[model samples]
Target chain A: MSVEVEVNENDLAEMVEQVWESYLDPEGINPLIPTYDENQPSEVHSSVSISGSWTGHIVYACSIEAARRAAAAFLAMEPDEVSQEDLSDVLGELANIVGGNVKAMLPPGAFLSLPQVVLAPESTARFPNTERISGVYGIWDGEPVSISMWHSRADNNQEDGA
Target chain B: MTLSQPEFAFVSTLVRKEASIVLAPGKEYLVEARLIPVARAVGAANVNEFLAELQRRPNPAHQRKIIDALTTNETSWFRDREPFAALTDVILPELIKSRATTRKVRFWSGASSSGQEAYSLAITLQEALPSGWNYEIVGTDISTEMVKRAETAEYSQVEVNRGLPASQLVQYFERAGAHWRVTSQLRKNVSFKLMNLTAPLPAMQPFDVIFMRNVLIYFDVATKRTVLQNVAKLLRPDGWLFLGAAETTIGIDDNYERVAAGRTSAYRVRTGVPAGASRRG
Candidate 1:
């Protein structure tokens, strides 16, 4: 059911901060809360959706350069040698794993969907009933990267026992 | 600090060229996690030192350790018990009848980590078949360490707990302090060997059933295809292929058609081809 854990803005920020610190370099810049940019490349965002006790999604949205950099960091490879498909896979898997781990903290018996890479941030806008948790993380290279978590309100209602 | 472009490229190239393994981007941590222990075991101070040694002169033993470390040994006895039960009741009965024509039944446990699966099959066959029923159980893994462990037939308490009924454990294993050892009779019916699924098929007789469960997720598309083809080559016509619950051959290989047996789904190699044709009919 739609069981809200009373997660405050501070807690959300803390979760994002911890995830970025542990998953990426610990010395990277603190993550900023959700803010959207229209000028960024429409083809740069990748996200993974996980459905378990709570149906939710995690997105790793950034520029082409940032995606390449994130892929390099995740795969422990050079950015120059990282192929587009490799970057897509790396980002998608990162989102999936992060989403899965976060979902584990939320509730048990949650089923994580396979990760998918997409072209536009707004593509996610197709799901209007999703509760969005968004943040912007700064990397050691001083580049701002955006990450978001979405939970479908409809799915939550469906999960309700009553 | 993040690895430079050259360093990442170098490592990726080394993984592909030397190990003949493809490292998916997200799996870099897996490489690091698996190799760090191996590097330490080989007395290398760090991954850099290990890589340096690998580059200068690749020791076969060290290479083997790396492969062994990379293999994910997540396995359980009678994992997804329905299949094994089905094998005991339905599949084995039919196979025994069919194989009676030849007076032999051969089963293979591909990706058989530490021998529980093969031994499980052997014990089931031993219990189900009449005395002196001729059957051979073969367990194979890419990791020599795993093969060795499987041959030893000794399992930790935790390992024995997973999917192994107390009744079966008591019957098949002798208490070895903290560990359980498969009885000599069970161990005698099974053989453990080292095999890489990506490589050519080993020279062996065709198997009536193959259990290659839960290990395919690590491979990319090409590797999966190659492995499936090789596995198909070793499977007898109408042989069964039991995969993990979450795994399938739908997009990966078409040589085997999915067959539903009660609650479980396994694959059967397509028949009706020329006897010598390599591809499934």
Candidate 2:
């Protein structure tokens, strides 16, 4: 029997919150909210694929507004002054850092793919055998935002034998 | 004048043709970020105005800054970990054994940025190798400003935080007010030089190992092939080449074959030929 310990929705939410608080900004200006729907949510997202002893993908997805606000807050710029590419880079770096930390929590020897940003949630669908873990929270501006994590069990099973 | 897609495209194409550096499609922001500040400093109103002025009268100083900014300096001591561990455990031991007969070992870092990678290697050698072993470390980069910084060996907090562990930092660096300077002993083993990889390498002794990581990604396939061939010429037949984790020589060049030591992938020049023949081969 293979034991796969997956991060829970709440734990994933806390991880995202902690990452944003520590790495991005301390003012807690752009708090991430975690939300889920019976149907998959449609939103802007960034993700990094983790491989090695245990293999999977970690994704950070949220609304466009939340992403823009987060980018502005992270860069310490007015929202209007933030460009789309800058927002994408900020979000991508966020996903990379959070994914890197999460990779540390997994069994040692996980390889991380370069981080990527996408326009919508469908982007995360490219990776196979994904399970979504998600949560919701309120920003300092009282905007509702969501954070989600996804893992692929297939990749984990392959690494177990190697 | 205002910045436009065509202008960005022109600059990207020129860089690719002249230097063989690849500027991926979405990286226009990087170009704009580097050029805008230089433009303002040169009294241009905007990026377009700067480009127009640059076209009308190309100032070497402004051009140098643009190139410096465009070059990515993402490096850290003992970056990616496994390679350095392998260097310490396997490569260095073999090199030491071989060099014992000759009494000297030489190493080069082809794209050393701000001296972190080169100094890291030096520290590793000092810690791992036997006392009184003779070794030389030479570092070179295209940016004059970066080479100057490397020569000074001082680093900011943000620069030091990347991959440097606190213990290593304490052992290797002398703290000044808010910055840290690499000790003279470590600095003594290595020398920094300004070199554009697109140009021919300087007259230097053959090297047992060359750490040319990460920089290859910037170059085009032809440039990669040319650079690897040039590197192979400079490398002793048994010497090793270390590339970034994401980089590989498989498709780009065949002059050097990949060799594995533990988890790290390194390259060695194909054997059974004289150094001159290998360069021609």
Candidate 3:
């Protein structure tokens, strides 16, 4: 079984863009544009873990305004009507959908853990013994957002080279 | 105005205490957007203003509306493919054989958002059961708002697009304005009501099958065990219980033993008999 494999950043950004265009914004005039920086600040974060073939985490983080916009788009309500719980669920679901798609690209037999949402001013979503493998940041509807992967640190000691 | 850190933490504690849905730290952005409405309803300008008012007084009604908005989910017909397949090929057949003598069977669809799962079960039953046999499906959820939506039995195209197939679309749903309304025949076999899974359950008729898929994941371990224990009482000894693919009874509860059928898994309640005595039987 392979432990560490190359996680292409463009591939993740493209998938996130596709999800945004298809589900979140049908009229995606300002499409997601990739950023060179990976450490994007976020007020809301939703993440899911992928196990089995690859042990890693998929994280989606965005600003509060951006989070509300996503929730408003998801629930088809005015941004004002979207609630705190709705924000968590929308972000969590976004992570789940994007994470599920990412899992399919991993080795056969990979499974996704149920998504968990976090609302901290400072949020860090690192799975046990895992470090950043590939990260992609982008701008969505004028708000900063990113989707990144973290592979197990054990992979370095045991399996080496990506 | 954007929600501040402390206010976010405050709302998190409130919802977790009330609903059992974990809004982990750093998830403050979630309810911040939704609280705009809540603030307005309570005569405040924003969530911050509402927080100030909440300190002075308690408004349970607006609090519930806030939770409902946050937790309500958009569901679709056959939301997950494998569960439905298990129902069509394995669970239903087993129940039909065991309950044939009674000519009646019942089902409970827990967290049945907007009646999709409940009606989906009804459709499966109508298709598989011998004609003229009696059957019913009862759906329950925590949100009364969602319960009302389920009662209406209508869905939008976006909702239908999620998992509903074209053939099932034509057969079971009739055109209603821009949305699709479940045909009257299917509606009769299903009903919806507000029931919280975290609370102790009311005594009810035992069911031949109970679908609590994807719902158990929302609660904590203790709530999961309580809900499953209640399920044990509601399900007939021979009845089937279906859970989300990711969820299991392994450590939470031991009353159910996994049974694999076709491409999916369903569980049956273990007989109270001791391990050694069961081997003799």
Model 1, which residues run further than 4 Å from truth?
A: A1-162, B1-35, B38-73, B274-281
Per-candidate Cα lDDT values, in order, are 0.69, 0.72, 0.76
- Deviation in angstroms for B227 in model 3? 1.7
DockQ for every model comes to 0.01, 0.02, 0.02
lDDT per residue for candidate 2 within B1-281, as digits (tens), equals 33478878877765665345788887666678667767787688888887777678754445545555565446567877888899888998888888887767788988887888888988888788788776789999877867998899987555677789899888999754335789987888899899877667677788988999876766667767777877877898889999987788887775678999768889887676544343322
Writing each residue's lDDT as its tens digit, candidate 3 over B229-276 gives 877878888788888777887787776799896698888788883311
RMSD for each of the candidates: 16.2, 15.8, 18.5
Tens-digit lDDT track of model 1 for A82-157 = 8989878877876775565455456446666677787455355755778765444444354546666677877743
Candidates 2 and 3, the one with greater TM-score: 2
Off by over 4 Å in 2: A1-162, B1-31, B38-46, B49-73, B276-281
Q: Which interface RMSD does candidate 1 score?
A: 15.2
How far does residue B70 in candidate 3 sit from its true spot (Å)? 6.8
Residue B51 error, candidate 3, Å: 8.6
Q: Which ten contiguous residues of candidate 1 chain A have the minimum total lDDT?
A: A26-35
Per-residue lDDT, model 3, residue B87, is: 77
